[model samples]
Target: MKIAFPATGTDLSCLLDGRFGRAPRFLVVDSETNSYQTIENDGNADASQGAGIQSAQAVIAAGATAVVSVHFGPKAFQVFEKAGIKTLQADIAPISDLMDKFRQGVLPRMQGPDKAGHAG
Candidate 1:
């Protein structure tokens, strides 16, 4: 499976960036080969710009089956889910540690709509 993470830096030690739509980096990791690639955001806001959608598209284009991050706006979360990709929201920690936990099945599988989706 391929997983993408919103990252602050290039390496796995980076913290998860909360803004899915405008995260500086999307680290695409392939679980089989353990190879990865980083996709850069084309400079856009988290909510109302094309860049966010494009970034999510790029991750899907790279064959990502899942995304890990601290948070996502409702729109972005819907995009991923609609594309049949799962989203894992959790405490932002080191990417390597997070990946290790995932590989070990220790990290909980995340579900549900974005918090921003709550129509109060």
Candidate 2:
């Protein structure tokens, strides 16, 4: 399974960014190989109108089946739902620890967005 994490930095040791849409980048990890790649949020972190949508789109394009984040906004959650992507919630922690919790099935699966959409 490929999982994407909204990250504050480029590696597993880095802390979770806590905001899915505004994260600087995403760290996509391949479960089978334990290898990973970094996907820039493509300036979506600074987007005024559609950050969540664009970030979700980027994760989908990265072929991630799941996204682990502190929280998500409504529009982004809807996008992931429509794409058949699973959303997992994790507390603020290093990406590596979050992955460990995920492998242990301790991370909670989110049923809906934890946050409201950005207000224009």
Candidate 3:
């Protein structure tokens, strides 16, 4: 399974980004192989409108089956739900610890967006 995470940097040692839509990048981890890919979110983050939707689409296009973030905007959460991508929420923490929480089932599955949509 490829799980996506809004991240501060390109690797597991980095912290998870708190703002999902404006995250610098997304770390897509392959649970099976323990390998990961970094998907740049700079372009989406720069969008004055629809940053959440744009980021969601990028994650979907990257083939992410799940998303782990501190919070999600309504539009982005809707897109993920519609696409069957599961979402889990965690407090700001190291990317490695977040993934560990996910694997341990300690992270709560998000039933809806935690934050209101941004100016988009």
What alpha-carbon RMSD in Å does predicted model 1 have with respect to the real structure? Answer: 3.2
Instruction: Tell me each candidate's TM-score.
Output: 0.82, 0.96, 0.95
Summarize candidate 3's per-residue lDDT along 31-120 as a digit string, tens digits. 878789999998988999889999999999998999999899999999999999999988899988877877887888898988888683
| Best of the two (1, 3) by lDDT | 3
User: Which sections of candidate 1 miss by over 4 Å?
Assistant: 45-51, 115-120
- Among all candidates shown, the one with the greatest TM-score: 2
Candidate 2 regions exceeding 4 Å error are none
lDDT of 2 by residue, 1-120 (tens): 999999888889999998899988999998878799999986998998889999999999999999999899999999999999999998899999988888898888998998988877
Each prediction's total of clashing residue pairs, residues at least 3 apart in sequence or on different chains, is 0, 0, 0
Query: How does each model score on lDDT?
Result: 0.75, 0.91, 0.90
Query: How do the residues 1-120 of candidate 1 rate in per-residue lDDT, one tens digit apiece?
Result: 988988888987788777676787789988877778998774644435454567778888889998887766666666887898887776888888888877887665557645563221
Q: List the candidate 3 regions with Cα displacement exceeding 4 Å.
A: none
Candidate achieving the largest lDDT: 2
Candidate 2 lDDT score relative to the true structure? 0.91
The per-residue C-alpha lDDT of model 2 at residue 96 equals: 91
What shift in Å separates residue 77 of candidate 2 from its native position after superposition? 0.2
Between candidates 2 and 3, the one scoring higher on lDDT is: 2
Could you tell me which 10 consecutive residues in candidate 1 have the lowest summed lDDT?
111-120
